[model samples]
Target: MVTRDDFTEERIKKLEKNLLKVRKENRVKEIANKMHEVLSGKIISVDMNPCYLNDLSYMIKKNLELVREALKKNVSDEGSTSNVP
Candidate 1:
């Protein structure tokens, strides 16, 4: 499995921060797509190291869950407040 610093960690964090700061749903979806891309790449690379297969699966699940929760929160938050100023 890849280390935390190598890929997608920064992208995910940045998108998460931006998700908190922005009210637009489109941006959130875009960021989520970026994350999905990262995950797909990692999964495709899994054959490179059979030893790390379990580790990579666990990390992918964790990260995807985090992204899902954040997106849900953002969606609900938007629903609870004014959409336009």
Candidate 2:
């Protein structure tokens, strides 16, 4: 019972949904890349500043906590996607 226009519309909707999913994945990758750069810079600073060792440890602990949370969220996202059929 689907007309030509209905089929085209459905195709367009699916394409748009796929595009949105790709964009979201790309954005997540970009954020992770930026986080890596920031973490590297922090490590370099810590290496250069012995006096800031305590601060570096604190920062590292906080960053690790954030990374753990992010990883958990990522795992959940992957799990949900895997369940899709």
**Which candidate number would show the highest lDDT if scored against the true structure?**
2
Tens digit of per-residue lDDT, candidate 2, span 1-85 = 9999999999999999999999978865655554566666733443445544444455557779998999999999888876657
Residue by residue across 1-85, what tens digits does model 1's lDDT show? 7886856887898989898778556645554564467666733453455534444455568778998999999999999999687
Please provide TM-scores, in order, for all candidate models, with all chains considered together: 0.44, 0.51
Error of 2 at 38 (Å): 0.6
lDDT of each: 0.68, 0.72
Let me know the TM-score candidate 1 reaches against the reference structure: 0.44
Model 1 is weakest, by summed lDDT over 10 consecutive residues, at 42-51
Clash pairs, candidate 1, are: none
lDDT of candidate 1 at residue 37, scale 0 to 100: 71
lDDT score at residue 84, model 1, on the 0-100 scale: 84
Model 2 alpha-carbon drift over 4 Å, by segment: 42-63, 66-85
